[model samples]
Every structure is written in C-alpha cells, then in structure tokens.
Target: MPSSLMLSFLFFLLSLSACSLKTQTTEPEKISHINKENYMIPGINHGLIQSPINILSNEKHETKNHQITLHFQDEIKAVENLGHTVQLDFSKGSSISSDGINYEFKQMHFHTPSEHLIDGMTFPMEMHIVNYAPPATKNGIPHYLVIAVLFKMGNENEFISEFLTLIPKQSNNTVKLEKGRVKLHDLFHDDLSNEMKNYYHYRGSLTTPPYTETVNWFVLKHIIEASPEQIRAINDIEGDNARHIQTIYGRHID
Candidate 1:
C-alpha cells in the first residue's frame, strides 16, 4: 500500500551520500549510558548504508523475485541479558539462504518500540534473527545478514512466550533453555514459507556498536503479535531498547 509520499521518501533515502548520516559523538560509552539521542557507537559511522532505515510499502518496490529460505533445526542453547537487550543463542544452529550464499543464524534478539520503520510507522516490538555468511573467507570476517520481524499488540505468540519466561530480568544475567526443547521457526507465522516473500530488502548496518554496513537486511511485511502481558514482561526487563532510525543515505531499497 504505497502512496506518492512513500515512493518519494524511498528515493530520497537512496539519494543522499553516506557522509551526511554520521553523527559522531564521544559522550557516554556504555549501553547503560546510552539514549536514543546519544548512541556511542565506537567506529566511523559516516558514508555507509546504516540501519534501521525505514522500509516503504510501495508497489514499485514490491517483488516476487526474492527466494528466501529459513532453516533452524537446531535446539535452543542459551539466553543472555546483555544489559541492553535479551538475546537467544542457538546450539550448532540454523542456516537461511538464497541463490548460493548461506547465512548461518548466530543469535536472535529483541528491541522495544521497534528499530526499522515501515512507511514511517513504528511498531510495538521487533525481533532480529542475526545470521552470518562467509563469502571468500578473508581475514575471517563473515558477511552479516539479519532478518527483522516486527510485532504488534494482539494475541500472545506461543513461540515467543515459550522462551520469554526463561529470560533473566537483570542486566548481564544469563539462562539456559532446556536442551532440544525449542525450534526457531516456531517463533514465526504458521504460513511463513509463503508469507516471507512479501518483504523489504536493503543493504544496511548493525544497529549497535561498531555499526558496520555489512548486512543484507530482509524485513518481512507480515507482522506477528504479542499479548499485553508478554509486552509488559519484555519491557520490564529491557525498556525502550530500540535505536533511533538512521538516514538511508540514498541507497535504493530493493
């Protein structure tokens, strides 16, 4: 459902150079000292395709060409409270791919108030499934790919609540999910195989420290839901964990 304004905004994002997006600062350094107004990302942030950029719902940008596959047959390993947010890591975990490149799922995390915006619309929560692909293993730095699934307030997600209860409330705390008890795909829509095609594609960076522009972002158009109690539990642990949206820098959204 794209309008003229949405299309205009899409082009405008890709029209600017990377240098303008840099907001370098030397203020508070830790996540505890961080706020949306001040993200002490320790790196050169200028002149790159940074995230979380707004994803427009325009007809021209729609596609049936992307063939995305999600593979997560691994069991849940452990969950950690990394001060800023809660993260779920898998054991010898999953892989998602398209064409020939394989993206290995590293871990999954959450952000309240969402990160990447859709047509300037911010949702209640966002889940990022972090995956890495090694392309020509040079210096051992693998290519990063993140699949972002946004959430609205509605019926409770069984998959999410399945593990949400195991998350530690204190920062730097960690917990272990019962071995061989969980699956990654369960957190997604029941019809994910067919629904994942309707997504927004773009080249962007990590929303946290060392904000590198080494990511192939796949943001699904379909949103999942979290009940009121589930939302309260997440917020109670890590309130307002989202990073402010970044400038698109004129990079075309596929």
Candidate 2:
C-alpha cells in the first residue's frame, strides 16, 4: 500500500479511539532509539514521512532541481548548552525564502554522527538549522524548513569554534554574547547560495520528542570540515543522542 494510504488508515484508527487515547507528557525512562514504539510519541510509530532516513544519492538526481534564497545575517543569539547539544536561538529576522514563504530561523542544534546518511554513509556531526514559515497558526503547528549541514573531520572549523567560546558546563545554563559577535557566516561556505541549492529535499519530522511531521527537509550535498577535537568535544557533551534511522516508508528523496 502507498504511504499516504497507510497514514490515512492509521489516523482513521486514531480518530476512532481519540477519546480514550493517552499521550505521554513526560519523557520516557528508557526510550528505544530504533523502535519508535519506545519514543512514546503519538504519531511517530505510524507517521509515513518521518525523518532521518538515508538519502541514496543514486536513487534520484534532483540536486539541480531547486534553488535556495537564504538571507541569514550575523545575529548574536543567546548560546546555550542544553545538555542535549549546544544551540543558538534565532529571533532577529534571520530567514530563508522558499516558494514565496520566508521561514525565519528559530534555533539550531547538533547531532554527533549525523542522523541522515548520504548513500549509506554517515558524517562525524550534523547541524540542523531550523526555520519557521509565516501563516503560523496560533493553535495549529506552523510549517518548518530545516537546512542540514554535515561536518567531516578535518581542520578546525573556525565558524563552529564560535560556539566553543562559551560552553556552559552544566545544563539549563546560557552564556551571554555580545551583539553581532557570533557571526552566522562562519557556519557556511563563502558561496552560501550555491552550496545550498545543491541539496536533497524530502519530507520528514523532528528527530526528537513529539516528532511532528511538518518539516520540509533540505540536506545539503556539500560537507563542511571540522577538527577531530571539535567533534570529540561535542560528543563528550551530548553523548550520542541521535535517534536510530527511521524507515523510508516508500517516500521519495528528491
């Protein structure tokens, strides 16, 4: 059966038992990284267009089919060590335009040993730059556009080094940064627009709790280089928090 038909059937069942359905409001004690049955999320175990699936480059050659108009400027957003990974919460209109919708940057976090694979291969680290598009609902969830950049071990990435400048040893802690001190350009190549255009587009969900299936994923083809020590430091803090890869569910990877 097609994934859409499968999802429709699953949700139809969910609706039948909606009154008795119970959702987990707290994190599970022992979550299964592979079998999402342990995730405790409502739609994860059944959501068709789930994320973190391997992108087989040979499956489709559509990197030339799209373009990116990312207008990101350096904003010294508050940097924090969220126990999961280091992150930057964006607010000052750092945005990307697609299909006439401007999805402004929300926050960016990391995964040691990338979640998405390129032709069955994994990178040392992956950065997820999440953005939110307008027409954002007050009650309903808004659409998201996530830009993924994978990092290979090599020379120290001075751009990523900015995050290392202030590492809060403990969780629930944040470090104050001077305005415009943390440059966004350090995160990407000089020719940001060109590199971003050559990317794999797909439909996926959040890699974490609630695992909402409302994201428009764009995994960049170009790989960024970061030093081994940088990668190791990140792992020491986060400790392999990546969820096991989800099934492709017959979804197209364009």
- Candidate 1 ranges with C-alpha deviation above 4 Å: 1-44, 59-64, 189-192
Instruction: Write the residue-wise lDDT of candidate 1 on 167-252 in tens digits.
Output: 88778988987876556556664555565676787767789876765677888888888897887788778889898988654555
- On TM-score, the leading prediction is 2
Off by over 4 Å in 2: 1-46, 63-67, 134-136
Report the C-alpha lDDT of model 2 over 5-90, residue by residue, as the tens digit. Answer: 99999998988677444332211111223224444448435455577889989876444354467776657668888998878777
lDDT over C-alpha atoms for residue 107 of model 2: 83
Worst 10 contiguous positions by lDDT, candidate 1? 25-34
**RMSD for each model, in Å, please?**
11.8, 10.8
- Give me candidate 2's TM-score against the actual structure: 0.78
Against the unseen true structure, what C-alpha lDDT does each candidate score?
A: 0.74, 0.76
Output the lDDT of residue 50, model 1: 71
